[model samples]
Target chain A: MDKILKSLFDFQRFAGESALQSIITSVEERFPANEEKSPRTALTAEEMDQISAAGNAYLQMEKDKWENLVNGGN
Target chain B: MAVIDGEEVYLLYRDKVRGYISQHVNQREEVEDLCADVFEKVVSSLDTYDSTKASVSTWIFTITRNRVIDFYRRNREHAELPEELASTEMLDAGLLREETLRELAEALMKLSEEKRTIIILRYYNGLSLKDISDKTGISYGMVKVKHQQALKELKKIMKI
Candidate 1:
């Protein structure tokens, strides 16, 4: 039973933004986002900074990886 | 196409990915960490992405979902993982395309209002039949019946 339900729910992951948006539209129609308390809270400034730093780090890592490959991994 | 510009992809998806992580993770620091981890993965695995199989947003969503699942598994050792978060085998790549999802959306729209509501509640919201019964004020038996009917209808419409 659980396995069946998992399979049913899993397919939605394949749904693109537009299709997922439609399902979300239906979900919100039945269950309004504001009517219920959401777990998400406004991100603090520090957290935002942290995320920015992480992005910069990843960008640098990706750049280095590409450079290494281009340089024949020297 | 391979992601030649990692920063571009990161900038585009960072907020959306952060929002999703914040929903599943309570700690502010952990949310930030997970968001970073997800983007790091996106950057590292850029070569593996096939745009034809799924859209960039869908790919990011899958990565985010998996990270949250891993977070929960690591943190909540004693508690049962929600059925919604439990990993399932990836379906065939052809079926994972946006076209299939569009077809599914069309089929879902064709369902009766009652059946559509039940299906969205069950699958989209990850609510169990009993939970749907309580929320909709329907009896458990009827919710189950309607859920089955909705699935049957979808199968017929989709020929799946």
Candidate 2:
């Protein structure tokens, strides 16, 4: 019974993988125009600064959350 | 203590989150938006996150799953039910290949909100049974059983 189940699962995994490949291919074909677009965007100095600040703020918030959760609010 | 860097978090979990969302969500743009929302929620709610109870990946996945469920619930009225539910055909092979994902999305839309949640957390997110139990506040055994049942139900709908 376990072997049968395993084989079935293996088949399902294969099907899922094939389906995923097809989906990715379809998406890529539909979005071929996206290839013309540059993946990198130029960030001005101010924009870079803002991004850095935001990153710092996000890190602080995560730290605070972790501390609170671990310290039990003491 | 060293802080958890947002960029590091993005590096570690972005691909996994995108993969999870893509498997379940049919819309390309929505997946991007949902991924942003998941990370935003993770950053905002980091204070409440308990690392010992659940890994950061599991926690973020829970948030992502909840966001997807909420999106479905909000849009449920406008979504059409798939034709297979009404037909005698056990599974639609072409539809499974073409529309199975969308159907899975709709089936997920049909699940009682909580069950849909557990299914995502366990399968898509790859959370451990114990982590799910802790995160959701359900017993470990119940989490395992429910995880099995949820997979079974999803498989049935996807005709896997």
Candidate 3:
């Protein structure tokens, strides 16, 4: 069952990528990447900490609810 | 989603979701805030997740996409160019175009859901072709063939 599911998802992802690439290529043909010099800055350590904290808290809260559904309901 | 697995799941998805969120947003603080909202939506909707319909990453990306739209709608006055290029200079120069992404998104939606999944995994999620095959347990050759066929269909759809 897992194998079948994976194949299904894999094929879908490829098709989506192909379509996106095509559109990008056509636009790049018009306006190539070499012309643009976009800055690539890394996120700060403090922001990373905040993201981790938010994710951890949300997961714990949701886990408690899921456990309640599984144990209490079941 | 077991209680014990919740943190593990969050850890697994945190960076990817961050990357996805950062693509739309400008400031790191804003990304963190939107990322929180996205995961919050994830956990809240965990009960409705159907693995047969989409992978965790695809499902998460969809949520991120919607949140981006909401973010844009609420902050239309902000005029922050998408992080896909993330350069106000380039945006002002008319170099990085959102219309290109919009067209690609339109083409992607026209594809069957399965085909859309492959594109999202590869291009959106940045998974390698081999990684996709391994994850799916699909033969490498078959994966390549499917990708080629998908490209052909997409080209036809885009009338390219």
- The residue pairs in collision within model 2 are A65-B47
In terms of lDDT, which candidate is stronger, 1 or 3? 1
Worst 10 residues of 3 chain B by lDDT: B87-96
TM-score of chain B of each: 0.79, 0.47, 0.50
lDDT of each: 0.72, 0.57, 0.58
Model 1 agreement with the true structure over A1-74: per-residue lDDT tens digits: 23433444454543324765676686677676446655899999999999999999999999999998999956
TM per candidate: 0.65, 0.35, 0.39
Residues B26-129, candidate 2: write the lDDT tens digits.
88998899889989987887677776555454456556656766666566796432221112123222332223344555656555656666655544334567
> Which candidate number would show the highest TM-score if scored against the true structure?
1
Residue-level lDDT of model 1, residues B17-114, one tens digit each, is 88776755778999999999999999998999988667776677778878888888888865455555563434333444455567777887898877
Ranking according to DockQ, highest score first: 1, 3, 2
lDDT of 3 by residue, B72-152 (tens): 768879775343322221222221123334455686678765455555555544456786676556677877777666667
Report residue B7 deviation for candidate 2 (angstroms): 1.8
TM-score of chain A of 2: 0.45
Residue B44, candidate 3: C-alpha displacement in angstroms: 1.8
Q: List where candidate 3 sits over 4 angstroms from the true fold.
A: A1-74, B1-4, B80-153, B156-160
